[model samples]
Target: MSINKTNRSSLRYQSIKNDGYIMERLEELAKQNPVEGFWKCYGRIRNSGTIVNHKKLHRLYKKMGLPLRRKIKKRLPARVKEPLAVPAYFTQTWSIDFYE
Candidate 1:
């Protein structure tokens, strides 16, 4: 068995593979829904049969300059107060006196 050196021509640097279709799909979805973020995009692509890494997706998302919409807090409307109903009969209404 003899030691052999690897050829220099085969040594080439390749750039990271980025699918244009995925980028386009993400761009379309991002435009359609600007408020949603990584997880949402991840789910959308995953459901659409495209599995992507979260980090890569986020990196690309930032690279594409997609802005996440601010979340607005949902508040319950103030309830309207109703007047207390008066008892029809004196016996029907029992009052309790408390000395606190």
Candidate 2:
């Protein structure tokens, strides 16, 4: 049995300290947005001047149980009923409001 040069590549290093921070933040954001992505959080953190490697964040994100985003269809707009002309008779006119 032998290993080829191509099979052996540069080792990926992960930081336990950074993983803790990343995991904490990932869980916090996940609570707010159930389908949040590491790349999105990476961009936000970078934009806030807290720049870090995307690869590291990606790894930490997975370790914290975050996954890829899923497609969700937006809800349709509600239909509104038009107001009808009021009848002169008191018994003939009835109004209902869901707010009540």
Q: Which numbered prediction scores highest in TM-score against the true structure? A: 1
Q: 1-100, model 1: which lDDT tens digit per residue?
A: 2245666655667688967878898898988887788678879998999878878888887788885867899999999999998999888988899998
Each candidate: RMSD: 9.2, 10.4
lDDT of 2 at 26: 66
lDDT of 2 by residue, 59-82 (tens): 777777678757799998998989
Cα lDDT of all candidates, in order? 0.82, 0.72
What TM-score would every model get versus the actual structure?
Answer: 0.54, 0.46
Best by lDDT: 1
**TM-score, model 2 to reference:** 0.46
